[model samples]
Target: MSTVMVRPLLHLIPTVLIIAALGLSGCSTSKPLPRQTAPPAAVQTDPPAKSHPRTPAPKITGKPKTTISAAKQSVLVSERNRASCYRLQPGKTSTRMIKKHIPAKKAATAAHLAKKDATATTAKPMTTVTRMVTTTSRCQPQSLIYARCRTGIDTCKLGDTSPVQWFACAKNNSATTFEPVAGSVLVLDRNARRGMPTGHPVYVEEVLPSTDNIWQLRISHTNYDRKCHLDQDATVLFNSTEMTASFMTGPWAPWAKDLKALGFIVR
Candidate 1:
């Protein structure tokens, strides 16, 4: 609280010191003293926390349903839209078009007269029908076509089954034909029980020019078991017309070409 006053010399000295210090201060900003701002705290950002994409759901639609009835039953829809509706019916089987019976309009007087006339006529009794037996065409016995089937033996190295079909060399089973004609059908074999073709059917290829060559025929088809082209085996020469074939299988049965070279024509 006591008041003290500096000597004039002492005050003058301090004031000079302050003026010198201020004059020493630079006119420039002094590079803003390198601004000591602190960086943002370690945030723990985790790379923006990756977001996963969501899958889309499927859309649904609806429609009507239909079902069929049982065999004996049928589906039908009726409509009175038409002035006249006709019913469908079955007609004759042999015809290509359908036939129908329609009602006819007539005068009452005429209709009555017709009715009277119909009544005046006497009716005849109906008769019962009797069935007749059917007979199939028979081609066996009339010819020895069946006896001529090949015995698997080829005069030219053709393989043969254990026994043979009728051959010329057979002691008593010589091959022969009673029916010889171009139009007639002759089998390659004479075996009866084995006559049925497993699957293949050998048709008569042709009737050769030679009369004794009835068995020498070309087969339209090879035995199903016979190899390809062998089905086309033809009897170029025939000592017998009754050559028979087993189920279709192979070789021309392989020597089909060889058989052809040997003058056996394709059936």
Candidate 2:
């Protein structure tokens, strides 16, 4: 009886040992559970860009200022006046008078043809050919003056008188003075050598600043060249003491030395 019991107990002990060994092997071979960490901290990022406000440009209020020199101003004024004067047209009567005064062209002499004579040395007469040349009048000084100075002069009183006759009309109707002034009529005595057969009358456009005591005048006239052409802004020098004016620069400057200056006619 003791043997049988002891054998059974031994068999039971072996079975229990095998089960424990199998449990230990399974635990060692199997992988351990991974440690849990707080979810990766949310990645920090820069905030979205903000829109910027636009700045308004300043507004301009008025016209820009400009600086002009005195000489320039004078020139601008003279030019403006001259342009205004040019816009005026000569009256029909004045135009007709100027055209009437235009000199007629002389007839051309007959052409003489000489032929050889076998019998004697004499010239043979042949039919003559005649040619005539004609010229048209352009403009006259008085007409231009009347038109330009209509504002300052009485054209009706002046009528169609030539430049030479303007002195008396100016003296009677206008104030004659030695002091040269703008918008005045300058009267010069006749000088055949200077080609001023009908004296000369010019309109004073401006009285320039003078370095010397003498007055420097800017004048506008026509027909001084006898071509019936207009000239403007001609420089002239006036001597109050001698009461004379000389052309400083112009077509007449070469021939006109110191012509007698009657005076300036101001209305």
Candidate 3:
């Protein structure tokens, strides 16, 4: 070993020691490196966007067009058909003229009815009933032979219950006197010598108003024609005074000019 080699070696030792110390100091003073992370796994995110609801398109229908065409065609076809039937030749008659001249079909039913009416005409043809008339007699008095008195008593049980004498009926039944009622009886007690013995009775069939207060009474009776037979219904005037009178005068007495009309027996 040489002295020179020893000295060189010592110097190399010092340099190495200083370099190591410097390296250690740099390591302690220096900041640590930041840890790197994978970019936050690409967070799938989206920005808010406006939303719109879908609207259905309007539907178009072919109904109206099809119907209109069909109806128009039908009307045109009908007019064409009618024109064929109604057309008239230049020299011939029109359909209207032919129809006017055409004879009506035979009416067997009408002919039969006419024949029946003719056969019935032999036995007093039935008169046309202008107003309704009941076939049944309306009178049902409690105790009286006179038709008028009987009718008064029966028709109105509450009224005319008293058995008034035929002559005094007007005086006795004044309270019950009213307008003529259909099917009520009228008594004729005018004169005994005039062929109206005791009293003649007539039935009222209908009452027709002539004015506000005046009325016409249709009446029927037996022997009105002096032939001792039932007479057809005849109309006679009933004045306002007679409406309230106990007994009104009737025009259809056989022997007397005026017949007494007993008050209607109606409550």
Candidate 4:
């Protein structure tokens, strides 16, 4: 065997130092360990929800109408039409239900029956109405009115409210009515002032007057609008009679009487 050589103490001292470092490695403070984090807990979540909602309506329609009922009809106790119980609404241009006219056949039958029923009837001529009455100055008779009369007649008295305008009677001067005749008293209607004063009444003793100078028959009129009695059997009148008797009367009589004495007649 070869002879083993031993290094010096200095070299042996370095070997021992290296062994000592390996032995002291457990005391290091810079080493890291494995992380121990808790596991993630069970995840909890909510389910989804809902929103809003909806609904619907109803119906109607058409035109209005007009009608007449039984309650609207008239019930007359004394009806002219015994057969027809009710009348409909009349047309604007038509007439209401009225008295029925006789048919032509019915009229002919009535005429025939009337002819058989006819008796001997007396026929007489219609004469003019003649009358006389006292009157005052308030009765001014208008002679200018065109009165209908015969050729020789002097006065016209037709007070009917027709085509013929007549003079009113003495008593009816203020009334709306009158008579038709010569010599009949005529009155001015309370409202009859056609050409004369109203409320006037006068006498028409003569329809025609006698002419002057010849004393013959002629168409002349003399109206006495006013009259005053002079005395018994004497009158102070305006016209006619060819006399104006004033037996010691007043001045008013003389004025009228003198005119009578002048041959001016009073109607």
My TM-score estimates for the predictions, one after another, are 0.20, 0.50, 0.31, 0.14
* Alpha-carbon shift of residue 53 in model 3 (angstroms): 62
RMSD of each candidate?
29.6, 21.0, 33.1, 39.6
* Tens digits of per-residue lDDT for model 3, 154-186: 332334343334425444555344576654555
The runs of at least 3 residues in candidate 1 whose Cα sits more than 4 Å from the true structure, single-residue gaps closed, are 1-177, 190-201, 211-215, 226-230, 240-267
Q: Report the alpha-carbon TM-score of model 2 versus the true structure.
A: 0.50
- Residue-pair clashes per prediction, in order, are 39, 0, 0, 14
Tens digits of per-residue lDDT for model 2 on 1-267? 999889989879989999999999898766443223223322222222222222222222221222335434544565576645543333233222222233235432344223333334433433434444444544434434543443355643556676556666666766677788776778788777776766777878789765565789888876565445667878988887787788889886886666898887765
Query: Who wins the TM-score comparison?
Result: 2
Top candidate, metric lDDT: 2
State in Å the error of residue 67, model 2.
26
Report the lDDT of model 2 for residue 83.
46
Which lDDT tens digits does candidate 1 get at residues 136-213?
333222112111232112222224321222222232332323433332223343333434321122334344565553
Report the Cα lDDT for residue 4, model 3: 75
Which regions of candidate 2 deviate over 4 angstroms?
Answer: 1-81, 84-125, 128-134, 137-151, 155-158, 209-213
In candidate 2 the C-alpha lDDT for residue 13 amounts to 94
Q: What's model 4's overall lDDT?
A: 0.29
Q: Which residue window of length 10 is worst by lDDT in model 3?
A: 50-59
lDDT, each prediction: 0.32, 0.63, 0.46, 0.29
